[model samples]
Target: MDEALWAVGRGTGVAALVLFTASVVLGIITRSGRPLPGLPRFSVTLVHRNVSLAASLFLVVHVVTLMFDPYALLNLLDVFVPFFGSYRPVWQGLGTVAFDLLIVIVVTSLLRNRLGPRVFKAIHWLTYAMWPIALAHAIGNGTNGVEGWFLVLSGVCVLAVLASFGWRLSSRFVEFRSVRLGEIS
Candidate 1:
């Protein structure tokens, strides 16, 4: 039963990471200058928003389950206070830091209109930082990290994020090339 609960927590963490990566990919693909393949621009935006919300929900589950896990020995303070855990304090603190970043990302996104575009965009940039921190937490603290299935899942999530970032970079390059050509022509 303990193992099962741990698996659930691990699975939820992985799922949330994947969803967050997907949201980032979709947002990159649907940028004003980029060409979104089949889906309408508005639809892509909507999907991105929904996926981000799902990721946040999964993160909540992950945190709650960790608190319950006997092995983690986490209290509410461990969730909010960085490095309070007696075991693996530094790595544990990384998870707490990631959680704080996630909260900022979600809150700013939810209140995007009220915050205004500049503020929202600044807050949203923290998502990039959150991803690496979360990834580090999983690798450092996850019990399932050594298992085959978990490894594959983590690889997939990482690859998806990398591919998305690559695509965005390529798109920017293309845009720049086109602009240069136009100027030359």
Candidate 2:
């Protein structure tokens, strides 16, 4: 039972990270209002939403399994309150913080119609912070953090996010400049 729980916990953690990475990339594309080579803009947005939801599901399972695993030494409070765990409190706390932020992001998203665009976008920005915190938690607390395979995987995730983030910023800047030039004209 312990071994099963540990495997599930680790697997889900990795799955959640991958899914979150995809969600962030798709979100950037959605924000740019651009479609992939063969897909429509609406499809991109839909995939982003689905990917985010899937990541959330995996994250929940990861936490649950860890809580049950004796190796983790996590309790209910540790899951919700940051820095409350006996095992690597800071790293575990980061995971809790990320989870809390995710909950807020999800809730606001579900109420997007009621919350209005400004509010929704503001809350959505939390994803930028949450991703890194979750990554840190995975590395600092995960037993496989120093393993070559995990390190390589983490490197790839970091690179993907950095490239996508750069694109997002550049696209926004271009849009701003175009609008300014149009106004001047």
Candidate 3:
């Protein structure tokens, strides 16, 4: 039972990280207002939303499984509140912070229609911070943090987000410059 729970915790932790990376990348792509190659912008946005929800599910499983495992040094406070764990305080705290951010992002997103666009957009931007916090926690606390494949995966995830973000920023800058120069009116 213990081993099973531990395995579930480990597997879900990795899965959540992968899914979160996808969510971040997709989100950045979607926000760029560009259609994915061979796909419409709406489709890309839909996939991004679904992927974010799935990542949240995996993250919950990761936390719950660890809490259930006898060997895991996390309590409810540790899982819910940052830096409250008796275990590796800093690393675990990062995870807690990430989870808290995710909760705010998700909840606000769900209530987006009622809360209005400004509120939704404000909370949604937290994904940028949450993803890095989660990645740092995974690298610091993961059992396979130093493994070859894990490093490769992390590199890929980082590059995807950075590239997408770079494109978004550069495009916006170009648009601003164009407008300033009377090129776009």
TM-score against truth, every candidate: 0.84, 0.92, 0.90
Evaluate model 2: give its TM-score: 0.92
lDDT of each: 0.80, 0.89, 0.85
The TM-score of predicted model 1 comes to 0.84
Clashing pairs in 2: none
Clashes of each: 0, 0, 0
State the lDDT of candidate 3 residue by residue for 1-185, as single tens digits.
Answer: 99999889988998999999898888877765556888986899899989988889999999998988888867889988998787778988999999999989988988999999888988888988999999998888877777899889889989987887787678453333344467743
Query: Candidate 2: global Cα-lDDT?
Result: 0.89
- Regarding TM-score, does 1 or 2 come out ahead? 2
Who is ahead in lDDT, 1 or 3? 3
Clashes of 3: 0
**Arranged by TM-score, best first:** 2, 3, 1
Regarding TM-score, does 1 or 3 come out ahead? Answer: 3
The C-alpha local distance difference test score for the whole of candidate 3 amounts to 0.85
